[model samples]
Target: MSKVRTCPACADGAAAGDSFCEGCGRTLPSDIRDASVENPDSVPTAPQVSLSGATPGPEHDGRPGLVPEDGPPTAPQVSLSGARTSGPDTLATQPMRRDSVPSASGGPSPSTETARSGGRTATSAPTVPAWPPPATGSVPVKPTNPDLCSWCPGRVRTGFCESCGRLQPRGRDHVEVCAPGAVGVSDRGLRHRRNEDALGVRVLPADAPHAPGAVVAVVCDGVSSSPRSDEASRVTAEAGVTVLAERVRRGEDPRRATGAAMTEAARAVAAIADSPGSAPACTFVSAVVRPDTGAVTVGWVGDSRAYWLSGGPSASASALLTRDDSWSEAMVQMGMLSREEAMRSANAHALVAWMGADSGQIDAHVSTVTPTGPGAVVLCTDGLWNYYPEAVDLAAAVPGAGAAPREAARRYVDLALGAGGKDNITVVVIPVPGGGGPRAGQA
Candidate 1:
């Protein structure tokens, strides 16, 4: 006989293989039954797609608009911005350039000026196209809703409604990327109408001349206060991931590749700026993971961070690997204040370094670690970390090491939402090779 399950929403009995509760028509808990048994071969699978959304892709299986059991949600119909549904798209080679440049940030100044934050002196400069720099090209993204006007049938353009002049959700209000060796999720959070955050992740195969298989994950958080911040973050992340993947595939050192990637990303972002005073800006962070060697190299410009979550007996203890280039962190580093006190100050989150046309001296910091055991690498924007700022606490909250990267990342996003997601949240989870069991010290 088939088993029965209780619906969490309506307290009604749901028969085996039922996906929706008959009583309330609500989605049944995923554990109710083996969905595959209902339709063994009808599962939705990701097809080749592109970031530009110019090519046609496969449609989702099952009911129209309904998300497949194991697949990410599909984009709503009538996407004005032409958002693509989440899928594993091909990563194309992009040109990259390398050069030394200055990076800096502080208060929003209408004109170029010198400022000191966290003891770093920087002067804003005009946007230029020449500074030599750097896509995991065309990873698909799924938006939360359509950009239709509520008052009329007209669609939303850019951000304003076409017929009623009202504001609507941006194309990237929500996004998910499930690559070969890593997975990432980005959401616009509760407090932000626009998702000023972006992500790019790719898994490179081992067929390259002299390099091992690797996974590249990049996250950028746009300076929300700046104009076109969303565009800045998106371009920066795309450039970083694309350039890093190419360099790694060419057998370049992870550190040098990371710095080179940052330079290119900075140029990409700077190109969007109208002037130094009104430049779009964002924070950048990346992780390059080589499973063969258990090597993880991290690179960063601002506060976005990478964390090592040791899961097995052989792995190193979970820890934060990158330092923030913020006023509060600088003060703490200089022995001017306690960590708690520095964080409490009003200017705590003021950025001392960032990527933009105006930022002076685009100095990228790189760190490397080779773990002996099993673990997972986490790359995230401040949105997720602002809630669980400590490494131990974050490691305790994540799923077991054996969990799939996509599901694990989904859990983190859900946690942030439950805790009142106040900022745009973006997170990527890349598992270290050879993890044989559950995550270590998981509470």
Candidate 2:
């Protein structure tokens, strides 16, 4: 009769030729088990590797206080014939070493067996080590707004849908700002993932300086290639408006205040960069419309633009206020390329100047225009101009007299979105006094 084989730890029976105990998944010793004989103190077993990538002593059970006080436990001397073990614990509790990994052939390879039989041990360095069991505890759940994501039942966290793995719409994805004398709209165009454009508009109080009813507006377009460009544009718009309002309140010249606002905006954008390589960048355009004197001062960097649309029917004339700091414009100005040729070049839209830490010393182009008749001051990013491409086309699209500034601004944004919205769009509309629109403070 074949002798019965059994696991020493669990006292479970093992069939003939079986290497592991089925009861607890423990390594089975090759030696026979019989009540007539006492079990051996030490049995040859597979080498074990610790979490620290080191070979542990024979008595190392990973539990503290097991080591003798005198010195480290001595390793046992035994012959490796059939049995192999990963550690003192059964396979259910202990992670297997990489070298003794289970194979299609049903057991360790011949080479491994040879090494073991020769009293040699080996260890494997797996690319990823086993991790400890997760701590057991109750976790607090945070309350969430279920309606944040439309496509998935999962909650939206940090602008992303956790279940569907989709990007969630942000607050700035579409924004509208309405003030007493100006209205602005910004949107994440159809083709972009988020809105990188920002707008700020404010109408000076009735008791303020030279231009009491002056409207201050700033539009910034984040450079798509820069990291956190959206943040750069937002901070720039905010800082520009704050400084412009402060300077204008102090009775500063419209042109000088616009320039100072640009300078302050540049500093704010520059401070957003955490390092030289990741400097957030953007294009800036600001307009200050003084309805009292019919004076409009525009300042700009990069390709964002400002335009003055003369009041009247759709056929009314319009003028481009700020010059673009773009490669095409620079080429045309230097006579290096004709207007049509420059526009056709691949670098046509490349910015020659922008607001960022890397962009040194910004000299904002400032211009003042005093229109005799009523008109509207429009400030926007290229997203809107790329569709119209001309002052007259944009002027024709503006709502006629008596249209609320907010309505006009929304109309312009809708026009851009209807045109495929290949990029982020932003537009600020400030009706010049006598422009025939609703008076100041009208929503």
Candidate 3:
């Protein structure tokens, strides 16, 4: 006799032959009697199909005249129909018990028993979506102006304006001056754009007793053709002045110091060229003076000039040091034309050699001059020289005439601006020692 078993859904005890639970009206498996008789470890295996065989229905499982257990009883019965049905299509056609089906959330439940008589593996967990989306706020940038100058215009925006040819300013701090002596710059004309390019260093031994009789000065001109020319000029001026001053302190000859400084500047230019981004080139001209010996040494590249203005009231000023290397000078040197022809040529402004040329050797024009009493040393860029035709006129109008050297430098700059200052202007003046006569405490 078959034993009775409790129904899991209704908790009612039923005999092996019962097809429905008496307590909850739930349906029971027809094979319960056979299942109770078989060993608990042995499960019923699915029926296999052969290539040459008749189609079988779930009614074949010892229940005669009963509805097929695979799907709804009312559905049409078709043998091996390719069409999918909802129920048996999900269970019967699915892959057999090589692996257990995972629960809806993931992983098989603990109650699930392995179809085979061995241990079962835990199903893999489902992947979850990321929470809390990324932040959407973006950083805001300040707007810039469109019609400012490239050298010193504040906050330029549009590269160039159609109306006035002025470039737009990039940002509010585009024209900031951050170094010593940079703040001392004073723009002369209202129309003139103030730029660091026009700034330079003119070092003279302080009237202080400790560093007497030594003076060093530098003049740098920004290449108007390149962007950031102002920065290049400022850096070159400051670095060149500092290095030459240190050399002077070490008692090196001013001529040798000038050459060494140019060599250093050449290295700086090469470094700029080696950098990844855009770099602007510039021209450098410098002079150093030993007031005690009346000796002055000068070094220059490109058109920025140095001149020795001498001969008291009755004497005429001569250009002791002029633009040593330029297109016009090159034409004269190559004998392609006479010096007068080159001077009058329309291409006079062309530069043959400058401090930052990519190719061709840097031709540093180094010269030494010992002037007679009361002479002046003038170092300026083309901006000032372009306007002043005669050295006499420049000497006459130079700032602080008959005053100290520093004052004279300031006056010369002022005069250049007063003369319509179309381009960037710079000037440095050093009065020869023993000319105005030696200062107190000097030999």
Candidate 4:
């Protein structure tokens, strides 16, 4: 004869032998029912059985005791022993909802355990940092044509400035028929009444190479003190350049060609001197470059000079060649007087040898210099060098002249003018072919 119990869920009275409530179909509290029937005297007191501070019922299947059904709803006394609970109060703080719990079927529900156990609290979403502050000031923009000449502005018919009539080198009117690699600059200084003292010409073979490295530069400076200096300078430049080109075409050695050219120039000056009302003398410097072999050969008479400049401590205006038919230079070299003293001597301008019939002996000094590396050759009359007291000063001006050949010439002329150009001024800049390296075929 088992005692009966009431279901907590439905309050349906059930027989002790039943495992479920007949009215509500809820599961029976087996532990509570069993304990009540087995030990009547051991009935839990109200104070101990109440949910406010309840005592546990008998253990079943090694689980912690559950509260008696007759008492107020109490929390189950969870024990160290392994046990699972399904009471409403036991799951009150859990995240899982009652609907989310699986039926009797053995599968997990969609319940995620809260991460509050290890003392670490869960955080919300993350944020990104902002970009750095804007720049302090605006960036400067460079002009597109930085090399444009300020003096000769805008386009003109002859590639010269229409406003000032200044000739622009490499302008549309300037012809570039010289050897492809050959480039130079020429200009007349301010003191000259006429710019005819300076002459430059390029003569190409019938079948000339398209590249610039094979060009020849012929530069002649007329004697300002002489009446026919302009014509003498022109003949020397034209004849010398032509003769050199003819020799190159004939496959003659560059050194020999330079010598021949100098001879021809002397003859041309003499022919002029023989003409009526002709100046007896003119000064000239000529250079022929073979880019393929990196060779430079030069010839000179009078006080004109040739200088080689390179990219080292030794890169200076090394007077590879010069002509000193002038009395001052000869006096200094002959130990008659110191160079400084000779320069100021009364007979400084008097010449013993020059390109004219009156020169008595037409002696020319031809010389060749192999560059230490990439370098430049400068040929000029005393007009330009007189102002440039130092060689480095002249070297520094080359790159500043920009790509405009005439601009470079203008720079030299302007410099000489500023230094009080007392006579005709002329300058020619010839860039050595190839990059920085030892040159071949140079003496």
User: Top lDDT: which candidate number?
Assistant: 1
Candidate 2: which stretches are off by over 4 Å? Answer: 1-168, 313-316, 435-443
**By summed lDDT, which 10 consecutive residues of candidate 1 come out lowest?**
91-100
- The local lDDT score (0 to 100) that residue 178 gets in candidate 2 is 59
lDDT of 2: 0.57
lDDT of 3 by residue, 243-319 (tens): 77667666776666777777676556545543322344567778766665655567776667766564353222333
Clashes of each: 15, 1, 19, 7
* True-vs-predicted CA distance for residue 35, candidate 3, Å: 99
Candidate with the larger TM-score of 1 and 2: 1
Candidate 3's displacement at residue 115, Å, is 94
Worst 10 residues of 3 by lDDT: 99-108
Model 1 stretches with alpha carbons more than 4 Å out = 1-170, 435-443
- The per-prediction CA RMSD against the true structure, in angstroms, equals 23.1, 33.2, 45.0, 54.1
Residues 118-164 of candidate 4: C-alpha lDDT, one tens digit per residue:
12322211111122211321111122353433233344443344564
Error of 4 at 119 (Å): 94
lDDT ranking from best candidate downward = 1, 2, 4, 3
- Candidate 1 lDDT, 1-443, residue by residue in tens: 23446669867555445444434435556686333222111111111111111221231111111111211111111111112221112101111111101011111112221222222334423221221211111121212245654334567676565785544433565566666577787766655545678888766765645445588889998875455677788889888888988888788987678878887898889888887666778899899877666566788877888877756444555566666766666566556767677655444565666787766553456666564446688998877887887665787887454256777787788778677666778888988765432222220
lDDT for each residue of candidate 2 in 1-443, tens digit (9 for 90 to 100): 12345558877554343344433444456553112212210111111111112333333232111111112211111111213332112212221101010111111111100001011222211111123211321111222454444334466766555775544444565666657677777766655555678877767776664567677888988875455667778889889887987798679987678778887888888888876555777888888877666566677877788876656533123556656666655566556767777665444555656787766543456666554345677898888887876655677777452246777777787788777666778888877645433232221
* Cα lDDT computed for each candidate against the true fold: 0.59, 0.57, 0.44, 0.45
The C-alpha TM-scores of every prediction are 0.61, 0.61, 0.52, 0.54
Q: Whole-model lDDT, candidate 1? A: 0.59
